[model samples]
Target chain A: MNIHIIGGGAVGLFFAAQWCEKHAVTLWTRTEQQAEMISRGGIRVLENHMENIYPVNSKKIESLYVEGDLVVVAVKQYHMKEVLPLLQNAAAQSVLFLQNGMSHLDFLEQVPHPHLYAASVEHGLAKIDGRTIQVNGRNKTNIGSLRSGTAGIIDQLQTGSFRFDWNENSYHMLIEKMAANAIINPLTALLKVKNGEIAENARFRAIAKDLSREFASVFSYKTAEDTFQSVLSICTKTADNESSMLKDMKAGNLTEIDAIVGVLLKTAEKNHRSVPAFQLLYNMIKGKENTPEFMSK
Target chain B: MNIHIIGGGAVGLFFAAQWCEKHAVTLWTRTEQQAEMISRGGIRVLENHMENIYPVNSKKIESLYVEGDLVVVAVKQYHMKEVLPLLQNAAAQSVLFLQNGMSHLDFLEQVPHPHLYAASVEHGLAKIDGRTIQVNGRNKTNIGSLRSGTAGIIDQLQTGSFRFDWNENSYHMLIEKMAANAIINPLTALLKVKNGEIAENARFRAIAKDLSREFASVFSYKTAEDTFQSVLSICTKTADNESSMLKDMKAGNLTEIDAIVGVLLKTAEKNHRSVPAFQLLYNMIKGKENTPEFMSK
Candidate 1:
């Protein structure tokens, strides 16, 4: 498969490095500096358990050709608007959004693709440096059709060392992931705590539960007690790994709070459900997201 | 008039040191250390424009007889419950609450006294060290009756050093202060920004405005525009001064968010009004408030 990755962050690099071993993989980075670094040093995969440097083709977003078997969009949620324009020109057979939040659907609508896959990365991969990924926690990745279902993309993706399943009920999975992000991401970011710290604190646990119940109601998904427990488990597993939102906070970068929490809040408003805790957290994180110091560029 | 000051932080000392020049005064501190420091060095009055220190007898709360005409409670909101017992034992005719937030009303029903005055201070004063106050702003003080019925207490407090107004509609004043604190205190604490920084940022301004609107809906306080602007102005005036909440955050002391944001949220829920911004802010701050580093032994 001629695979193209549309973001050079940890997730994009993780897939590109793994897939390039068997396929022709092209990685898209936002900046020329990042592309240059990857061109010279290749992609470095720093697993939590082991250290290995893998070489992969890296190119700027503008340099990529429009034809590819698969396209992976792994950029931050806020960048989707700009990225969508690029994807509109891409002649990819399948496009998968392996990013945080729900607003990606809006961007996906703008692109000309029949097969759209929306998935969440359960694996914990963080960008340590340019094109360097630190894989922590035994992470599972799930992908499924958003609209006009794609079948072979999962098999094509599985050709690499990536583990993914064809999720028939991916909407529920996406909603659950959004709920977890709504409760966990902004909480950890604002509190300046790790995911495990949130798990450790009963008050935070209660907050997560409150937020989860609200999400379950608005999205019409079963936000079971086990879902919340799973969230805490993720926090425990990724104890030292700063959540994406927390990493954004530390870097003073824009967070995916709007897509994650804002989407949940908007959904709640539409459903006539009150999500006080989620709304509050979304606004707080949004404040950080909107700050110039936190902006991507 | 004899005035007894309790919880000898900046407000208590500000009142005791100034009022003692004209009236017989006793400043009651919680700790023996503060009592000893004040008893030996006296209470210092550091105005934004002027500077002076006055010696007043500082006693522990247990030793306070409260035989004065007016008693001022200047401790933290969390300390209110602990100090309520002491107030019940006091013999004061009038009790004045000079702390931030609306939690003083918690003591409203417990008051055996005839005159109860609630007040808020904008004078940016912080005890940088023992017996030292850095007054960054020459802000006015507001005093009013919780009920429309108490005028005598307001009359007595009018004799204090700063500007004082007898507000028959003090509920709005309390709400205004609460709203302002909800926005300013947490933003300053979380962003590690000074007051002026909040005003400069569009994001913080949005947060302030959103929170104010939510607070107004719940509390029914009306202003021409967002009342949080007034808070930002106050921060600008006290630009170099650390906000009380920021100071608490720095010292790892408990914040009065429960008294400020939490109480407002509860009131909103009771009134069937939604306060999404405040709820998230309350949860975020509440989580921080729960940290062991925040609570004093």
Candidate 2:
């Protein structure tokens, strides 16, 4: 099966390096410079203390023909709108989306596709340069069908190191991941600490619990205790990894606050639930986004 | 009038420098080394683009006899407990407590004195060293009696630059300042920004307004809008200054989180009101306090 990944970020390169070994995969990047760099040097992926270069096909988004068996949307949630039109026009049999937060659910519902799948990427991937990405940690990708069964492309994409688990309900899985992200990402960014600090630090743990309780109250999927434990477990699992939001803040780049915390806050407002902690976290991240350094960029 | 200032922090040194010009003042500090340095070199105060050396007597806490017309406790709120016994056994006619937050109000009630007053220091003061302090900004100190009238020492302590105003209700004044500190200090420290950012940034302003509303609901002394405006004005007045809590975090010292946010959160809990924002802020500050670097210190 042929696969087309829409994004040149860490996640995009991560999946391309894995799937290129088994299936024909093409990576689409926004800038021609990034596309040229990846096409010339190949995708250098650092995994398990070993460096491997994969000869993956790379193309600029403007000059790409997205005809493939599966089209994977791997960009940050903020850039999803810009790539929506292209994804809609793609001649792909199945569409797989790998974005954080539940805000994209509404947009994904509007896209017309015969087969649609949503995924939660549990791995920690960092972009070292234009074409080089370091795999800090590896975890299973939970993918489930949104509209129809994802049987056609799921098996073809799963590899030994890049594991993929089939989730029965994609919405529930995505919501669970969103709950974890909503609690972990902003707090880590605001506190300027690693993921494990949230669990290790008693004060941060209390906050994580309170935020989880607020989230569980809004979603009604799991109990507050369950949500809190899940978040704590994730923090423990990725203790050494710096959260994506923290990385973005350190790099002076825009974060996924809108997609992650913004969506949860909007839902809480709609449900008449007060989430003061989440609101404050959201505002703080937004404040950082509007800082002079970030504004100039 | 003889004035004995307890605590050689920025506030202690600031008041000692001003009062020493008119009254016989002695400053007491925990460390004998610091006391010796201050006794030998005097207290160097930098204010209004000029440096002034005030001849002030200094003594270690152990050798100090708290006999004076007025005893001003200007230590951090956390250290107030350790000095409470000294203040209670003091031979002073009047006692003035210049610590931050309402947590000290209960402790102040236990100390017996002819004139018991609580003053909110509005100036921005930073301790440059053991014997030197820079006055970042000048503002009036609002002094009010917690018990009887403060007649003997109020006028003697008021200076041209360090002005003092008598407030009818010292409890109200302290609560007002506590509300502002509860909102400003933790937010600035967690966001890693200056005081002005709280008022200047739109998102931070919203969070500030929300937190102010929460505080107003618990206190009921002022309306939400009034509390928000008061905090906004303070942020504007001290725009370039880093909050004391922020300074403590940077210096890897313990913050007065218990005195400021802790008092508010306890009040909220007792009244059965949820203060998620304040709780989150409290936890984040505590998290920083628990860091290995701060723990070692």
Candidate 3:
């Protein structure tokens, strides 16, 4: 099987480095410069204090061809829309979206793709530099089929370090993952604290409750307290780890604010639920994201 | 004339350095170690590409004696209560407060001192190291007499660099100054941006308006829109500078959240007014203030 990984980010690099052992992998990046670097030197994984290189064919997304490939969209939610047209322009045997947040879900439902899937990539991977990825935490790719009558892509994607799980219902899986993501991602990014801080810090926990309660109103939760408890547990479990949103903000990458907070805020407005904490943080992250680190004298 | 400056922070050092030249100035620090360091080395002023030392007597707050001295309480709002008893122990000729926020206003209302005053010190100052200070923005100390018919302390506080203004109505002056501080201080500190970013950044400005409106409810504003415009103008004027709260957070000092936001929240709660934005920032600053930067592994 041939896997075409869209995006040369930390996610795409990790997948390409892992799945290349089982199947042929081609990496697609936004720029030809990154593709050329990866094509010439290959992806480097700095793991267990050792440098290991994985060979894969890398190309620019501007020249993407997905006819005979299983295209796994690994780009951020902010950039997912830009790449969606390219997938529609070509025909892939299977298209799997590994983006965060529910922003892309609406766009996916309208598409006539017969074999469509969405995934939650639960991993701590950092792209150190050009074609170099540093793997930290263990990874599990949760796959859910978006389209009916489609055999999932779980069988095609497995490696020694990479794990895969097939969910019976994709929407619920995304919601569950999002419950944690929506709570943890923006808070860590805004506060510039580790994941555990949200649960450990009393004030953060207070605000977290506000966020969870607001989030619960938009989605279905038995109680906001139960939702908050779940979010706190996730925070405690990943206490030492800096969230992906924090990492993205630190690296000056555009965050999935629109998909995660923006979409939920839209729902909240539609429902007439007053979610001040969520709205406050959304505005904060948007400000920080839009504003440069250094300003003029 | 003798001047007693409480709290050996940037503001204290600035006043002490200026006043010591004209008056018999005694600097009071929280610890004996800092007092001893200043007593031995003198206060170093790094200015205009030259390092100059200003000599003055320094003592620990524990050994405070304000018999005939004009006492200037230049402590942060968090530590104001701790030093209040010391002031009560010794009857100073005049007691002038140089603190931020309206938190100290209530404490001053019942005090029967004939020469009680509240001040708003507008300056950008940074203490480089132990017993060393770096001045940035020009200084203006707005003095208002809290005790009715008491002569103001502005006449005794003239210096070449340091400026003072007597506010006829102290309450209104503090409120007006607070309109800017409450918005700029926490926002700049929380966002980790310079003062100007609040105005320059659209998202920050939106949240600033939210904060301004909520704050206006606690106090009285002609309109929240007017309050926000004033706050934005302050941000634009000091766009290149960092707020004292941001500097304090960076330096791991206790912030004026309690005095600024905490007191406002209390008033808001009393009036049955909803100030979620103010409450959110208060909680955030409190969390960041209480939580350690480096967590135990």
- Report backbone clashes per prediction: 3, 0, 2
**Model 3 agreement with the true structure over B110-133: per-residue lDDT tens digits:** 454567788887776788876998
Pick out the ten consecutive residues of candidate 2 chain B with the lowest summed lDDT: B288-297
Query: What's the CA error at residue A233 for candidate 1, in Å?
Result: 4.7
**Candidate 1 lDDT tens digits, B72-138:** 7888888988888888878977878876888778778987877777887877777766666766665
Q: What is the alpha-carbon lDDT for the whole of candidate 1?
A: 0.75
What are the per-model DockQ values?
0.29, 0.54, 0.41
Q: Candidate 3 local accuracy as lDDT?
A: 0.80
lDDT of 2 by residue, B18-107 (tens): 888789999999999999999999999998889999888998896445578888888888988789887878888888888889888878
Please tell me how candidate 2 rates in CAPRI terms: medium
lDDT score of residue B247 within candidate 3: 80
Among all candidates shown, the one with the greatest lDDT: 2
TM-score of chain A of 2: 0.96
| Native contacts retained, all candidates in order | 0.29, 0.76, 0.75
Interface RMSD in angstroms for candidate 2: 6.6
Candidate with more favorable, higher DockQ: 2 or 3: 2
lDDT by residue (A63-128, candidate 1, tens digit) is 445698888888888888788778888898778888787888776667677788888888787888
Error of 1 at B154 (Å): 5.9
